[model samples]
Target: MFNRKHLEAILITRTELRLPRTTPEAVGIRSTAIAALLDAWKESGLELHSMMILRHGQVAAEGWWAPYAPELSHMLFSLSKSFTSSAIGLAAAEGLLSLDDAVISFFPEVAPEEPSANLSAMRVRHLLMMGTGHEEDTMGPLSSAEDGDWVRAFLQVPVGREPGTHFVYNSGATYMLSAILQKVSGVKLLDYLRPRLLDPLGITEGTWESCPRGIHTGGWGLMLTTESIAKFGQLYLQRGVWEGKRILSEEWVNEATSKQIHNGDDEANDWTQGYGYQFWRCRNGAYRGDGAFGQFCIVLPEKDTVIALTSGTNDMQGVLNGIWTHLLPALTEDVTADPAAHEALSDKLGSLTLEPPVLDAASPLESEVSGSRYVLDENQFQWTALSVQFESQEAVVTLENCEGEFVLRCGRGEWAEGRGVLLQGAPFQRGANHRMASSFTWRDSETLSITLRYIETPFYVTSELKFNGDELTAQQQVNVAFFSPELPSLHGRRS
Candidate 1:
């Protein structure tokens, strides 16, 4: 368990203003190109939350979709692997550990009594490069370990191949990196990088979820603003020097981002390009640290650009395709500003919004269901009862579940702020305060539809409540999920 003082010390606030904001045209990218990019993404139905483009060390164009504000930090998912790699690089530079160190050496007590030859030879570098030699991903066993000893569980997994000879996208290996960093440095991954990396970058608000043992889950569960991601990409682009100070050795930067392993042979697929130290090589002489559901921090050395994006879509490749198709080819050194195009781009950015439901007109059933309570039957959520109170422009929904009763608000034709938990019984840890932005619409005369977006993570649930006289039927479906997106329908009676 983490000490309270140490957990509290994970937070440190200081703003270092260095990334100057500028127009796309000033940076050699046409403003009309950016406007077109947004239009194309919208046309493709890609649920992008925010985007930040940096060229020549300056922010060229940045915008956040409605309800995804600049201040809000987004979940990084596997992109957290890149940050964990950075911490490992720092630890190596400090001489606390070496990449050549054997993985079992860090946790000698938990290591197998008689390790296999492949497991014994597994080195720290193998973990960074996704070359741990395990035939399959070890994440499944690591997560479901009943004993809660992740280190032991990981070590017990059979290493089927020689270390550094193969590649499997094993998230558990990244977790071991975090466990090693904490074991050697006696601090969490975020805390260890605070002074060396985060402070210099002016990343004040960030959090990394921890494992059962209180070690930071290095493979995922990191949250930071879009600007922070941009700064990190810029730092890597600048060869680990931040504001003229060398935060990381130039040698480490080269090694970490360079192609370290062969992942696949499909030249057309971006993911098949190559794998680095927790980074992925891109098609256009670029490298990136990306996450599930389309979170990205792409660094283009050839173009001298960095593009950061947060999105909620299953089509991760589609998001990258939009960047390559629209934003990349137009990046030139020639400066030519189209005033009219710039004005249009600015207006487009300012007015960018996710359209709320169109069928928001007041329903005939609104008066009949207003302030009425429904006692739901047996369900997975343990939601015993639900009530909706309608107002002129919003509807207040209250639900009583196993956790307790909670209230949420859905705007009639816009997004309204609210709070609720998601995937409560799931394996991952839930934040103490999970926020939501809900929009409600009358799908028909008898059905009330609501879209609840968990703002911090890439998840949105569409719930439909159908009222038929003395009974009600409710169904919920998520936009994207690892498992089934549709949940079992629920029936209830007016109480």
Candidate 2:
């Protein structure tokens, strides 16, 4: 849990001068490039979805693509590592542990009876720097182990290079931090960070998934509103102070954001910016936290700016180059608003909203099956829902299809209440690739469906919901093969 006094400290505190959206840019940005960037972003097909720009602590520019909204919590991907690193700093401040401490100190039992030089020499700092010397462990192979053996599994991996001598982009290393933080702090990462970070920033609630070991996945599984990521960038922009509270020490910020390793030196990667604790350096002096597809919170000290972005996969290099070639040039020390142009630009920024997912026109079948019923239409093409309750004004559904089962409550969109499930396997703590893009399209009154489409493999899946009261049926289909394998469609209409 978050420290109570810290939570109380910021609860009623107020800022003397609230930050404004736009700083007085003496030679303000060129209004023309703003539209140009948007066009280029879309034309490039980089799956660029939402953007928020803060200049001098105000929302200088912000916008979201259709379907994507400011309110939705986006996957941070690798960007989550930065938060993990920040938590390390916070824990250090609280005297929970120090980065310099030996990682084995937290898990003394994980070391082998006779450890290798690298294994014995490994420290917590190396893990933060992606220099853990693990030969090869990706996509959470460590997670498959018994919860208690996870750390041991990681430690047992042979060191390909000396600890702290090589820079390997390792998500597994970050997971260990999540595990170790829990071990040392005696609290889960999100809950521990709530008052210390979230509550202070006004993020009242969010869901962060835990690994099989039940530790918050430090390297991934963090979901935050696009705006919240912007706030984090803002906090870093102010060097870790928010609304007058010193959240993190300056020393931690300097070390974490500074280039700790040249990660992509041989790989010829976009992280051309270099790697810090969990942050990647940008072309200029800016640093950012990024995820798969596209989730970014780029902070530039020289420009006194922060840009928070969420996106789907298309092209990452294009996104970075677009920002640099277009947006960066516009960031002048003196930016005077073209009143005529400013209105349009303001209209452009912070504009766009998702239309409510509405049920389509009713049909004869829809009226007939308005309540619920047991559906065992196809054996392999099977769908069954449990707890298929219907309120006068709502639809409650919990269903399992070939792909997976999700419990959705929608008073508004697809779900009967506030919950929802994607036709694809839900987002997992393993990595960024696990994210699913589920969009809803109501087929008829009796059937509402969502498609779980992946940017990569395991793509193109559809889930159809058939409604009745005590019995409900759903169908899941993958657009992969001409003939998908027959599945034994389990049948049990949830009462």
Candidate 3:
């Protein structure tokens, strides 16, 4: 039960989620292998968010780190570039546009009277290969610009070299292709690719961040379930064939996977495996779509395998190093039937689970926020800009600095337990945990109040909650990250 539905659409057909032929009886891996792999993976000190192994197309093994579920969607970061590249391929196959089309074609109205020669020479292919020859980085300049116009501005930058002569990781360049796709197709990148690829592949629940004009952020801001990421890898593994249908032409896939661009001296260079359209070459002779904080869709051609993972890490290259070192050695060219190993592995794999949320670890969490009690409102709440709110089933509690409100219902009778958990605005925004502690209490039997506490203790986040009827408020204190301090206290009562 490794559920990647929230992280990405990982649908391995019962037929595809099989172990190597040498291993029958049960497709599950050996218990020893599972222990060794997890030990090796965690040894790096980086949390393993989601991991999937496809053996001859079947899911051989899968797992997740604590507080992270196979169902939760993790941000794809720059690995988003690969999806954007695939969208272009799907669009090209449908005759919506051509890869060789001029870069200027997408925005005749936006280009300057005297466009740079390098700008004129750039093509869709160039964008896919990170050969745009523009600025070395993207998000910096484009962050504040309008969505429709951002691509053109990116194209206008001075050329670092001739269009195809150099290889730089240009996120803005990827964003431009994403922008161009919308401009010409007359539709968002997600919508266009939804039916052609996502729906067919059963990739659902993917989230894309949008710019002011409502275009999905092309180079980044994609969140996918772990399963969805795996589907992408499998699609690449099968050369674009799925369920007896050819979603993308093998030619396009071959071209995209081939080294169309040259990267640098590092081990994971695009040039090493030879850059394809949007994919880069990995150390294992594999082509991969990777993102910041370690989101990866790695397709191993020679090994006839695929490994898709979503992680939060500062060192991406080191993440791959862990896989290459431990997992690679687990494979053997000499195949043999090992039914006992497979069964034991399957049982061990089944043991992995995420701990349930502690609703009442602190006895103080048990109380009823009742009646309309106007407690002391702190001027400190107005210090931050984030919206915050607090509420109770039979009580009124109000807070400043909060943009949203949460209402708590009594679980039992007069001695009802706390309501739901209160998390901050959003988690993963600053690459940190969402920290909020919420509890409720009843006041005068006519009103209820809630208090949320937050503390980020450098290494992790801890929270405390206190609720009394006369006053309704909450405090967010984090030990890990320092968010703009905002305090919002409000009381809720049946009106």
Q: Of the candidates numbered 1 and 3, which has the greater lDDT value?
A: 1
lDDT tens readout by residue for model 2, 81-104 = 888888888998899888888777
Can you tell me which runs of candidate 1 are displaced by over 4 Å?
A: 1-18, 423-431
The better-scoring model by TM-score among 2 and 3 is 2
What is the TM-score of each predicted model, taking all chains together? 0.95, 0.74, 0.72
Q: Which candidate do you rate higher for TM-score, 1 or 3?
A: 1
| C-alpha RMSD in Å of predicted model 3 compared with the true structure | 7.7
Question: Rank order by lDDT, top first?
Answer: 1, 2, 3
* Stretches > 4 Å off in candidate 2: 1-19, 23-27, 146-148, 266-269, 350-419, 424-495
Which of candidates 2 and 3 reaches a greater lDDT?
Answer: 2
lDDT (tens digit, per residue) of candidate 3 on 159-247 = 76688888777888787777888887889988878888888887766767776668887888787777788888898889999888998
C-alpha RMSD by candidate, in order:
5.0, 7.7, 7.7
Q: What TM value does model 1 have?
A: 0.95
Per-candidate Cα lDDT values, in order, are 0.88, 0.66, 0.61
Residues 1-495 of candidate 1: C-alpha lDDT, one tens digit per residue: 112233123233433454788888888999878888899999999999999999999998888777777777899999999999999999999999999999999999999999999999999999999999999889899889998889999999999999999999999999999999999999999999899899888887789988888999999999998889999999999999988899999999999999999999987789989899999999989899999899999999999999999998999988888888888888999968788998888888766667677695689788889999999998877789999999998999998887688898888888887666774533234545876788899889999999888878888888899999989999888887778888778799999
